[model samples]
Target chain A: MVTYVAIGLLAILASIKAFHYYYQIKRAPSQKQLSKLVLSTLRRGQSDRE
Target chain B: MIKKIAVTLKPYNRVPFVYQKLKICRNCRHFTVLGERDCMSCGKTGGLQPVEKRAAGIVRRDQWLTGLILLLLIVIGLLFSASALQTVLLIAAGAAAAALLWTLSKRFTPALRRIQLQKMFQQYSYELASGLAIDHQAAIRVFQEGDKPRTYEMLREIGSLVHNDQLKLEQIMLLQTFQLRKDMDLMLEPLLMDSFSPDLVAYIGEMAKIRRDLIKENTFRYMLQHEMYILNMPNGETVLAAVAGAAVRKSRYMTMYPYLLIRYARLLPKDRFLRLYKFAKSARSGPLYDEVMRIYEEKFKWDPDFQNA
Candidate 1:
């Protein structure tokens, strides 16, 4: 009975972790996207300054 | 045009006298001040301009809230480790918390960056307005230096920005630096000399006392300067009470209690001091309050009749 309970808990924890990772991947921009946005913003600001 | 020229020339005639009083950049390593259209030392051709002070980035309310939630989840997870079910629940909570934080950061990073840049510009303007002659480069250098003595120097320059009037931003910056480095002597020196809103002056005095830098006599004198101003205001009294409580808890500046209490006694309602005295008497005696009460008795000599009556 204890072994079955432990397995269930492990499965639940793993599922939760997987779900969270998937959600983050969907919600957050990749590092490349973030860097590109930052660089473009910097260029725009510099042009405006000039 | 003749009147304008005469008016302009008038300043030159007075320049010798004023120049004697003015700080020259030649001796100052941080000096960026120069004549019209050229830096005298560097020969960089531009009008002699004062340096701008920039503000640090502003942390928005949402960012703080998200950060707090993430911290709470992590703490809860650590605390629930004894129970397997609870631990598992907490681990899930932690994963959810991280995901939320990541989402918020991605959405808000640009806005946060803009707020930060604006703050830097504002700080730069404040420094220039204060006569610090700080440019962006100098400001960056000052921030990068980041040693106690260097921080103190930066604070001193910033404090100069607060003269006869209370400049809130300048005062906040100075206080922020002083909070990091408890240099009571440096912090109190300007407060002692300058005229400020009674609440701010009192707040600074309380801080000075917390650091055990204010002797009873000096604290009494400071209180006397704005006694009526402080006594009439509720906010001033509240700030004083908070500082006193904090000092008692910290116990590092125990010697400053007498002066602080004296100021409190004079400004606060009789009932307020009475309650405070009761709290102090019942609370575990520390070096701070012991010295405070000792000084209060020695200086004022209330006798046995006024013992928490």
Candidate 2:
């Protein structure tokens, strides 16, 4: 019975961790996307200044 | 590299004298006037640096909440489990997983970038402050050469070190050289002087109208005590007009504005006082408005528009 309870708690914790990992994956922009956005913005700013 | 060029451009390498002027009150971030060692706002000892911006409270709140929830889960596990050793092991594994996930999420958060930028700013400001302390001319060169944001940071640190009106005034003049689109009003607050030059008075008046909320009590006090000097400036009346308008718009400045106007009433010309009286009446009717009316009556022998209103 003790072993069963421990397994249940671990399952719950793992589910929570899995959900969090999914959220992180969805929200965070990839490095390539960020760099491209930055470079484009910089180019536009320089052109505007000139 | 810019810093190197700036030093080479200095004329005499004279200790700019202005860099060592004012101290920032760490508690309230108020700039104490020269010769004063204590902050008037919080009565704290003046320091060389004001507190920098910190990460938002929400980030920290989330961190605490995560820890608390994990602890609560562990506690529940301990209570329900029959074997203490198994429960301990389960709790430890759960805590490790949660902490790992928390660390991973925190690394990707915007707060990470904010912290990184703040660290960069702090290091740059420290070097700028030390360079200015050692050689004033070198600092000026950097100010001229550095981009707007860099110049902004340099001014922020230099503001904490100013000790006199002259230095404060010079700081404003230096700021005028930069045509930054970003609102530089808050950073400029510490450098506001009691006796503004004509142009500075106009700038103050413009800033007062646009960013009235940023005006500190010290500013009103300066206007009150140095009424003669401010009123004599070319833009003195305009400054007073803007200040009066600000007082009417915001209840915060209303406390000082009414008293300041009354004290300066006896000194103001008839037309000027009349203008102030009209401006004060335009705000919502209050005890302050009535008091201002009474002052107007006493000075002018009668309130011209009071009966009509």
Candidate 3:
């Protein structure tokens, strides 16, 4: 009974870890916006230089 | 006459994305492209990490926590197991699960890291911009202090991530103050601007004389786009000839700008024309090749350099 309980816990923990990684990867935001965000933010500094 | 200082600026680290050059403070979340070891805002030692590395660190810590939890649970189960067979079975199960978790995490580490990077940028967009702004101000203050080289260096670091015409202009203006030379580490591409500034044309002329290798398509395009304006400036034709001489350094350039060579071929010095002669000697007949031949026949028919070739 103890053996079965430990086995079940291990399987569940592994499944949870796998799911966490998969979900994190699947839900990744589009990287396209990232470049624009950085460039636009930096370009804003033109006001300071002027 | 002012002395020309041999200023050799440092090379920037190559990164896949410009933002990767930015470091965020762990304590203050401030962004900086400067090379200080500590966070400028929080004054905390060892608190700064490149944003990408910081994101990777967060992902790695989470992975470690999961691994620890799995290890702890496995240990607890082993200590409480009643029979040897049960213990053995539990050990095998835990090992299999741990391996599976490890494999999955390892396989998706890069994807996980990208997500973390995006999250950091999204969460702290304002901070990133403000941090770069702070760096710009600091550079300005340095400029106020009359440390032109240091200020240019600082601006260069910031410019890697914060590219704009203003930054390029600042760098160019500072460069104009300095007497440029061949030995100094200079760059051309980063300083090219959309608008025609006489200062930029002057810089291009100097680059042509000392570091002609740096001249490429964009530099050619920029120079040609403002040819009339450039010619309006004194010694503009001389500058164009130097650039043509630079174009002669590469066959690809000759192929791309045969018309340019044709215009400036007569102006190229004997040394440059000789190089053109050697290159044209092997190249299949083309307009540039014909022009080089024409220049040779017109000017160098009796020249010793052509005689040797």
Instruction: Return the top candidate by TM-score.
Output: 3
Q: On a 0 to 1 DockQ scale, where is model 3?
A: 0.47
Give per-residue CA lDDT, model 2, range B164-258, as digits (tens).
56546655665455442324434436666655465466556666656766556766666566667788887686677666555544445555567
Query: Candidate 1 regions off by >4 Å?
Result: A1-50, B1-155, B158-169, B176-186, B205-209, B215-219, B238-309
- Per model, kept true contacts as a fraction are 0.00, 0.06, 0.55
- Candidates 1 onward: DockQ, in order: 0.03, 0.05, 0.47
RMSD of every candidate to native, in Å, equals 21.8, 17.3, 3.2
After superposing all C-alphas onto the true structure, candidate 1 shows an RMSD in angstroms of: 21.8
| Pairs in clash, predicted candidate 2 | B21-B162, B21-B163, B22-B161, B22-B162, B22-B163, B34-B163
DockQ of 1: 0.03
Question: Which stretches of candidate 3 lie above 4 Å from their native place?
Answer: A1-6, A23-37, A40-50, B1-3, B75-86, B278-294
Query: What's the lDDT for residue B233 in model 2?
Result: 83
- RMSD in angstroms between candidate 2 and the native structure over all alpha carbons: 17.3
- Across residues A1-50, which tens digit of lDDT does each residue of candidate 3 receive? 75577688889989988888889888765445565667776666445545
Candidate 1's TM-score reads 0.28
Candidate 3, CAPRI quality class derived from DockQ: acceptable
Tens-place lDDT per residue, model 3, B1-309, is 346565667665666667667889989998888968888777899898987788889999999998888787778888788888888888898889888988998899888887888878778877888888888888999999988888988988887777777888998888888878777778889899999988788888889998998999999999888888988888889999999899989989987877888888899999999988888878859887888899899999999879998
- lDDT against the true structure, per candidate, is 0.43, 0.52, 0.83
